[model samples]
Target: MALLDYWVLAAYMLGIVLIGVFYAKRNRSAQDMFAAGGQAPWWVSGLSGFMTMFSAGTFVVWGGIAYKYGMVAVSINLCYGIAALAAGYFVAGRWKTMGVDTPAEYIELRFGKSVVQLYTWAMLVYRIVGTGVALYALSIILVALMPLPEGNPFRDPNTGNLAVEWAILAFGLVVIIYTMAGGLWAVLMTDVLQFIVLNLSVLFVLVFMLQAIGGVGTFIEQAPAQFFAPVSEGYSLYFLMGWVCIHFFMVGADWAFAQRFISVPSAKEARKSAYLFGILYLVSPLVWLMPPMLYRVIDPSADPEQAYIAACLSVLPAGLVGLLIAAMFSATASLASSQLNVFAGVFTENFYRPLMERRGGSGNLVTVGRWITLLIGLLLIAVAISIPYLGGAEKVIVSVTSLMVGPLFAPTVWGIFSRRLSARAVWSCVLLTFAIGGAFKWLLSLPADGSISPSTLAWLTKHSAVIELGIGILVPLSVLALFTFVIDRNGTPGWIPDRSKNATSNAGAMASDLPARVVAVAMGLCALLLMLIALISHERQLEIGLFALVTSGISAAIYLLGTRTKIAPEFQRAL
Candidate 1:
């Protein structure tokens, strides 16, 4: 890395650490630590929520996927906007009304302790594994670009540099410490700042990429037409629906996302914040994809990741590059800290402390939460270290997370909206989904020697996991519904919630004249203007620069207006 780059990165780290230290001093209780005292402005929570879900994985891997498959990769990310809207529209109010700190608590209240415990188990798996993936991706970028010593252990001859590995570990440790120390306050606060950095850097790099690629027309001419088509490999409408359904269920039910709801002041604010989040989430992918897409069009033979790294390095000056690097690290830290925080909260509130003590007060549980944070951090470190041995970075994340969505999604969805399903049905569907999904993947992995026709089995082989997942969800839900019908032979079903109580919510008067519609229209107009400039302009750099200016200006304007007017009250109260 350049000297300026190092300086910029150092400043970035210093800034984040100072922020964490500031929050650490204020983290006196579990509520302050875990929920940020529900005082986060809708803008802060909403933007950070967008960044937390987007992360480096989406930028790096999804970009690579875009390079290979065109726009089909967007199908995955578009799910977030759809999911966020659903959550904002429906689940946010319920989460606020329940007033539970974690999803496991909701599960326990709605189902039983055993079920909550199961959810906690799933959460632990999710946190450690997810951290491993994030760590792996971060390591790849840092190691590839940063300068290092000879024979460094972290460096692989076939790969890049080992110094980068140590850098990743060191950075991760710092994140764990702050997360463990400051709790959610540290995570959320740092995440908001990081989101700003990430967005700015992404915009900067995207503009540079378009300039390098000549123009939008040239890029489009050289790039695959399919790159703009946001459909999955199977090329079926069902795949899109399935993708949307899975994310809608997962994000709505996920503790990681739902905790934000609890951390907001009221149900109405949470809903408003979540609705705002949908727009922010939709824009995140475009930031990173511009570079990768341009790289594919400009230098089709180039490594996708390398292209992204080069784009940043070549386009951004040394100090700014360092800032971008810091931004990248900050992004990873934000995610890691959030994961660690949520994991601890879920474990203490729903698992270890509950199972250990029947009547323990909040104090005892809070103490347990602290210990779980440390423990989860250590486990994540171990997993992060092992990520290199797992072969390709992106493949592992998509594969592990993919299995989760297909099987877990439907039941979670069913449980929330329709409470008729019993624990038996839930477990049955989960197991059945896993079995079928796994089987489908196994079958698709066959004919591995390139014997299969590229056209017929191309999509199936490419997305065998998705197919199995589809079957897994479908079979289990169908069987469970059938089984539920048979078991209700006596004309009386079990475990249904009282309709009146189930519908009740603490939804107060939402802030009237929410600017969501106006902001949407403004952003849409800005996007249209940029597209026109990009299409009509003759100069490549001018087109991209103009596009960047418009997109960023609109995004910044919306955020500023939202924060100052509607969202500031929440943040000031929290402070």
Candidate 2:
């Protein structure tokens, strides 16, 4: 990377911080800080939900699969679409209808305070570890692209970049600042900005790649036949289906996602937001994952985990390379910020507020929330350094996440629609299924060493993902079914409290065009930035110029539309 590229990265980081400062004043209370005061547009909320599902993992993990396994990578991502669509129809709207500020409140209402305690700590620990892994994964990418001087003490002897520990801390502090300053609104707005950067990067790189390789047809004809296959050896059809099931629980019940569902104004809007998320997932993955697959044709021997970055570095110009890298970091930071905001909200609302006997909220709620954000941010940095990727441990951690998500949240989702289900069912399914899964995995699954061949061992490793998913999901659901239908036939309706807003309250608030205007300005500025880069670059002028031109045209149209959008008199006054 050149000095211009580093300048672009520096400018991008500064812009993100400015955005956080811009939104900071709007947050006056913990509710406004954490929940957007129930004012976020459906599209913004939906887009935010989509981005939260991404991280450095998308580049490192999924992109690695795309490079090695082919269409299965896109196939795996498509499950998020199916899972999200299902959630929109059955689950997302229900979460909105429950009308709680946080998912913990809903758990407490449906089960009890004890379940709330259990779920909060469980989710907090889960997300903290996951976020740390994500941070560590991001440093892996950055170090490959931007290594430090060989003699610098901070530089890693292996890869020569600032050691992963320092890189993780730097990223963590950036997340903490923006999240603490602007809260969810900052998180939401940055998500929108990152979406723009990511897709623009995708569009530009795809065009350049297609040009260099002759065209789409040439690349496809040249690619390995396996690249087009729906399923591969290890990522089989069963694994694909299991991926869908796991994310259904994730999209519908995980607090980071559920927060989006509950942040919207009404049940109907919640459905729309989730539907938008689903539709984007369905359409976007093909475009998003194709670059790595194309890179396989260019350099099949490239490290799988570094394939996406390697592809971008090959096609994108100097400043644009920095922009693309910035976008990737933005993806990881946005996800971490979402989790940070969520646990902070949970701590502030469920733990701290209640302990102070001020469950109604307090004067220092926002202040307290920011402090919690900082604490968790530090914890994430610590955990990132402790967790090492020895013997491809990152992949192991990814698989663990998939296995654990299914069992952890399946019962919570089941309770959403089933009033007859009780707290006992949640506890039973989680603990019992975990025990059985551990026994089968460690005890029964292992056979005498002479009984297993190398080929069989590899096959088992590949196929075990699906089996673990099956046990995690089926065991919990079966337990819930047994308890509800056979064991506890006399159970009463679970108390699903009504914290929902009245229809009259919603009728008084008209839709605002602020989100549209926000998008317009964001796109317009991005185009201008691209054009500036185009002027400075001496090579590939046509390729870069076309991208800038099309982007600017779209920005202009969005701005015009936003300007003409008429607000009701009362709503205008309110905004």
Note the clash tally of each candidate.
5, 0
lDDT of 1 by residue, 484-503 (tens): 56753343344443445423
Clashing pairs in 1: 70-227, 71-227, 154-162, 155-161, 155-162
Residue ranges of candidate 2 with Cα displaced over 4 Å: 150-153, 358-363, 389-394, 440-459, 499-507, 510-512, 566-575
What lDDT does each candidate get? 0.66, 0.81
Residue 326 deviation, candidate 1, in Å? 2.2
Error of 2 at 405 (Å): 1.5
* Superposition-based RMSD of candidate 1 using all C-alpha atoms, in angstroms: 7.0
Candidate 2's residue-wise lDDT over 16-123, tens digit each?
Answer: 788788888888987788888777768788999999888887888888899998898899899999999998998988887776788887888888887887788777
The residue pairs found clashing in candidate 2 are none
- Residues forming the 10-long window of minimal summed lDDT in candidate 1: 506-515
